[model samples]
Target: MSLQVIILAAGKGSRLGRALPKPLTELNDGRSIMQQQRDNIYEAFGRDVSITAVVGFKSEYIVDRFPEFNFVYNEQYDQTNTSKSLLRGLKASSKGGVLWMNGDVVFDPIVLKRAASIIARDQSMVTVNTSSVSDEEVKYTVDAEGFIKELSKTVRKGALGEAVGINYISSRDKAAFIHNLGVVHKDDYFEGGLELSIANNGVLMEPMDISDLYAVEVDFAEDLERANLFV
Candidate 1:
């Protein structure tokens, strides 16, 4: 089976204040953020990958720009959060493991390169940046076994790092994850699903630290500025 990849781009990124979908927002390099992500995916996985984009909020803009990607639409985009959009993406994936990320994140292509070996082992994991941890970003903490214990923006007490919006669910854990994600509130981010899966189903995930590399989740204009610095 081909490697399955997902890009969650269903929100109207009002913070970035862009007329285009946030993923379609152009970087200093001239390629749109999603375009760069697509290029990087190709670089890491070669032509055998199956890329799926979950689109909403002027979906046409993204759809037209990347026709090569398979699409899953989130009709309730305005009212729902990443959990719902990601659930849709997960439901659309074929059997086997899947890697997913926020469409707006701009990162060094090597980030995906590093994930390749670990992914080949079929271990579920979330890429994290230990160098930065803030209330605004999704934070994570591990249990005694060092598997991720808590994951959310509200995490504070034992936060080890910020999730970089890139994550993988192994085939062994996919069904439980999909079910856990289905129970999350519509307003919750997908982190809630991971947490629920861990607690409710004992799914274990390692935190792959890529602190030395750059991965920016472009939530605002300032974030884009920082992302461009590394591009």
Candidate 2:
């Protein structure tokens, strides 16, 4: 089966407060966050997988800087959250399952490869990259079977996992999923819709533990510095 990737790059990076979008923020390796993610995905999945980046905020800057990667623009990005951005990319992708990821995260290529493997084995499967939770990171509640029961960045209880901002979705289910996604509350994050779909619509989700793998996602200047050290 062919694999496709949808990179959500529309966020304003308000936490970073940089002139550049979060995706365009500089990494320790001197490459932009977008460049690092794109390169990492390509390296893991190769040319067989179709990759489309969903860009907004500073769409022109992204297009001009990385002309090689395919891009789809989301005009309403300023008013919405990640769910909308993901829906836009899902609509534009070709007929195949997709690997959905956040533009702000930095992760090992092995995580992508592992997710692809899981998706290949089961078309209904969605994968979440998880790690040992820290006080500062977002957390997830999983059932006894390890399926994600709930996810929150701020919930104080029952949080044993952290979402690494990666997911897999089948093409056959994309339309229905995206349509249902349109009804999500405006302020909800992309994962909110995903958790709803998994619970209410019976979407199959799997977890991939990546505690051994290390990558730094930049949400603040401190995180940027951490990423520099890891990269």
Candidate 3:
């Protein structure tokens, strides 16, 4: 199956306190977060891999800047969260395996390669980083067999690690995945929707342990600075 990379880049990023949208924020290497992500995907999956970015905050900037990739505009991005943005992108994607990533995250291309490999067998996969578990991050608990048991920010104890917002949804689960995203309230994050899918909607979310790879989600100015060092 063809790999479809869906980038969720719709948020205004109020926490970052930047004029540019979070994805458009330039790193020290002079590439925007979104640009870096696109480049990494291309390097790992080759140029034929389909890429669709959900654009909202400064959507025109993204459209004009990255003409090579496809875009799905989130009209209510200002009023909604990542869940809605992701749903819109998912709807706009082609029928194939999906490798979705938060546009704000910066990581090596090896991470995408690993994700692509997992989606080849497993219908669904989620990246987990045991090293970065914190109070602020979304944590997950796994069964003894290593599947996700529970996932949330309030999960304090016995968690494997934080969900890095990079996930793989197989072509087989596309309908259920879309239903899961649609059921989630617009105000909730995409992680909340994923939780609902796992807990209630019966989505089999496998965890891809990525502690060996360097990955960081850029949420703050400090995070952007750290991501600069990463890219």
Candidate of highest lDDT:
1
Q: In model 3, which regions exceed 4 Å deviation?
A: none
Report lDDT (CA) for all predictions: 0.94, 0.76, 0.84
Q: Give the per-residue lDDT of model 1 (tens digit) for 110-198.
A: 99999998899999999999998888999999999989999999997989989999999999999999998899899999999999999
Better of 1 and 3 by TM-score: 1
Native-referenced Cα lDDT, model 3: 0.84
Locate the minimum summed-lDDT window of 10 residues in model 3.
Answer: 114-123
Comparison by lDDT, 2 against 3, better one: 3
Q: Worst lDDT window (10 residues) for model 1?
A: 60-69
Residue 86 local lDDT, model 1: 92
lDDT of 2 by residue, 1-231 (tens): 567788888878899999877899887788888888888887887866677888888788888887777888888888888888888888887776778888888777677666667777645443344556766665677777767677657758877668778777776666667876687876667777777777778765666777778666678898888777777
Where is model 1 more than 4 Å wrong at Cα?
none
Return the top candidate by TM-score.
1
Clashing pairs in 3: none
lDDT of 2 at 92: 85
